[model samples]
Target: MSISPDSTNQRRRLPGSDAPAQAPSGRGLPRHLLGKLATTPTHPAITVGETLLLPLLAVVLGLAFAPQDPLLTQAAFPWPWLVPVVLALRYGPLAGLGGASVLLACWLGLNVGHWDVFPQLYFLGGLILVMLVGEFSSLWQARARRAETLQLYLDQRLEHLVRQHYLLRLSHDQLEQELIARPMSMRDALKELNQAGQDAHGAGPTPQQLLRVLSQFCQLECAAIHPVRDARPQAQPAAILGACDGLKADDPLVQQALRTGQLCHINQAVSAQQDTLYLVAAPLVDLAGDMYGLLVVRDMPFFALQQESLQTMQLLLCYYTDSLSMQRLAQPIVSQVADCPPRFAFELQRLAHMHRETQVPSVVVALEFRPQALKQDLPEQIMRLRRELDEVWPIEGPERQVLAVLMPLGTSGTAEGYVRRLEAWMQHRSQQSLAEAGIFTHVLPLDGAAPLRTVERLRAIAHA
Candidate 1:
């Protein structure tokens, strides 16, 4: 993703500085000199040049103006010490000390006998001042680098999200036209795939059905899906669509996909490829890096091989892998809590996977109502109270009715707003507080903890 230079410069601007924060560009003398003075030097060669240049320039200027006193000892402001101070501010203590050592060398070689008395105080004061300024420079420069790094990361993340959003909107618009021909949106196809995965309590559809769906959505004229064994694509194809030859494990595209664990196509410039067997090679991998299979496409429409189609194919493949993985991941929760709906279990597992990968928190709020509360249709009412983004799973029991609300990308603080909204609704509808209505709330934040423990805790709450 491309970060805008204007935005980056805006972000890089430090307080009290009019010019933008920038690294040394190592260009011509003026820019290079200004950049080095303005920013900390990252290149070792620049540091060496800077350390030597500043001291030598100071000595040359001192010789030109005060030939007898090259150290500028008789000058009003002790100008010779300014070189070390500038070096210190530019590249920290080491460069500053190096500059100071040069001046010290000049004093030892040229002025040791010229001065009747040793100028210990003059050298000591300059050394102390350089060290202090160098220390100060080191701390702030370190802070500036860290800030820039953080800003760069945030900018890249923002760019990625923006691009993804744009693609999502474009796909949605295209899906409208595609629906007339295919009778399915990407969301609908994914839902069907998810349902298929949940069939027979998580056995999922076979590879043949998977390839059929991919052919339908991605317009794969001829393709084969081969099961990967021991991190390698097997020779025999698990599922084949249209005319297909045997699997070529040595295919360049296939090898590229295998090595990178990503989608690779004939158009990629990773290697010089005058000839290739397949048009596209996509690894059926999930966020957890589990390789389910390798999909190699031999033929596709000229128009259908664009970015949208390729991304859709990869997305569907990832969704398929995640669905199968979710089955295994949700098994323990389902086994423990038989009342948990398949959809709820799948979503919980997916959220846990998201949390692990991105550290994005999801919340599960269990609202338990008294047996009498059910008469008011509390579970149903609370179910209606869920946000559009929330997924509600209502569990009914003899003594208590529980409504589990899954809030994706929510935090404890945000969940409180939801609870507050629920409370307000309850007060208006039933004219009673939660305690009076005999409803208790339990919150579980999915913050990288084992999701099984959450299910176990919920099971205990349900039984209690």
Candidate 2:
């Protein structure tokens, strides 16, 4: 899951540009003012609090600042005029009118039974002005708030769409890399096969090894590699190779893929009246382009959007089958040689252990090489090798650690010989580069009887 440089750059820009539409209005408001506004409740309680506070403050100020004159009293009758207006703007016309009524009542109570003391016309006029202003302000504020809310919603939707688009793109890139990596695995397998072909005697992968590789590459729940038998299509069941979960060889999709030499996509299948959806099947074609058997995959949920991805995966599987065929053609030649590295020998021993334990024919092989030379002299060699290997063989583990190699399913007898050829090639290269560079080679035995502890094994090898 390495992020592309472009994606990394996009992520960097995301934090700064998030909610760009809201930026303008948000920036316009002072931080303290925005904070206070946010805390202000949307209920009428806020309006009531404002009305009570403003009038009381205004009356206190008036008593201290203004002389007790009849003219001043008349002018100051609507002393807390701003309170009702604020209440109306925040809580609507009804709230403003109610607040004004309460203030008016309070004023009348103070000047009750004293018509001469209070100018009734002036007081009435002040109350009417407050109500009018409050209502008008409230109407404008309500409209503004509605528009703002609509704009915010639109912005959110737009951002969501943009993020989805980005995720899709990211997923596409990942798929491409996975597809590209497949061929590289095949190429590595081919390299082993080619060397085996040239060596006159070597060993090669077994069917079980191939199945394990396929399972790893496809991220399958289980993989069954069956030998095509000349029996009635309906009667023969595919053989189970490497499986993460327990699945019968007689599964419908598995049987279909084996019989037809065609990829089967089982969207759903009924198992005990339970409809199970999302499955894929692919055919294994050897290097000679001969259809061997079907690669049955189950329990994977496929979406419409993942059609292209699934198709690509199928292509990779086909390529793997072809590479396996090529390796088979080269195996007899390589098997005659007994000379291989200790690591390769250890792998062979492990494969022997698995064969005895599981009663399944399997073998382990290793490709030893100097990565630095490949990187320096053949800059595109890695990519080339990746493309080739992925076509025929799926990688067992991390690509960074192992170059390209194939583990053909159901392979036996000559696996060690195939590994020996690869070892000899590495030795030749190491000797050739000894004058100018330190050349080191490491062998990894896949399908060994011991558990495939990738990190620990690689670490031990590096230290060794």
Candidate 3:
């Protein structure tokens, strides 16, 4: 059966990555193949001279030793029979009987002058024995050859089944991801928000409208809104309402919400950060997976963390994200690149979360380079290091020099081996250690965060 490589995610090795060849499965050679497979272990050949050499020698010896009298021919000597038996084992029944006939003729010719019943009987008995041996050898070889053929056929079938299995699994994963991309409930929620936005007829901005809903209907005070598309890190302040009026993207509360993709609440009652800013924080992301910003709240004596409040915030934030995505879609393409990071990071974060649930010993490693520009040769270098199951993404800026490598199904040992190779390569290229070259790695779970969060946290650490 024919199989397409794509149908089973055919794995190809990149340059510089070496893998050993697979070992042969079958053990001993089948009997049919053994006779002709090779002349000897070290001297492999199938010359015609070699095949006839022993049989020809046997024939010469038999002729020279033949008796000239009937009395001598009566003795059943086995020397003359050896040639026919050897031929029978190697060339099968036809050659065996033919050789026996030749020996019989030689004996008859040499002893014709003193011919008797004893010589005739002796020739007949030897011919019959040689013929039987030839027939048995021929049948045994045919059966062995057929067995070898059947083994090969079964091995091919097993390979095809394995490919089909991988194809099915890949299809299953794709379907699951599509379902996760946009759930029906999230779609319905966005539809209602779109209807509301149309009815209002641009009476006010969507972000301001969302903020108003949280303050009045949701009973949340000290709230703020930040549009992710217009994110300026710590350079710009988010729109504010109460005590959390000056909260920016750099605030620990907002970072926590963005990192975890959850509504983070600061337990100020414990007084850990005596310089407390916000008490509640949530991120806004649409069903289409576009991230808008954070909704942070602080200093509300009556406000407290509850499941009902968290759910309310989630719905409100999703509506705001939908409104913002529509706004950006109306803008020109050139202005779109600046807005793509958060949305991309958002989607990647969701995928990372899904991957984390599997707990399949995955690892994410970051490679840092100085001057915020990768060398032209770096892509080739990185590709060589990558496996078929890996994902590589550039992070940390418009001029992202920090590369993150996600190794799916990687064990701790695998990670360590990869790191050693990387270090060796780096030392060879730049003659500098990783730290001296402004290169570093942030292995996943080392920072106790998801891959995307770990990247963001790593970026934050680098800047600090």
Predicted structure 1: lDDT:
0.75
In angstroms, give how far residue 271 of model 3 lies from its true place: 10
* Every model's TM-score: 0.54, 0.32, 0.28
List model 3 lDDT by residue over 39-148, tens digit each.
33333243233344554566566556653432234444656567777677766777677676666555566556745554556667767877888888888877766555
Give the 10-residue window scoring lowest on summed lDDT in candidate 3: 14-23
| Runs off by more than 4 Å, candidate 1 | 1-171, 269-271, 341-364, 370-392, 406-421, 428-430, 436-438, 443-464
Tens digits of per-residue lDDT for model 1, 232-333: 999899999989979977877788788877777776522453467998898887545689999999998877766567767776776677567756776777
Ranking by lDDT: 1, 3, 2
Q: Measured by TM-score, how close is model 2 to the native structure? A: 0.32
> Model 2 misses residue 228 by how many Å?
51
**All candidates in order of TM-score, best leading:** 1, 2, 3
Cα TM-score of candidate 3: 0.28
TM-score, cand. 1: 0.54
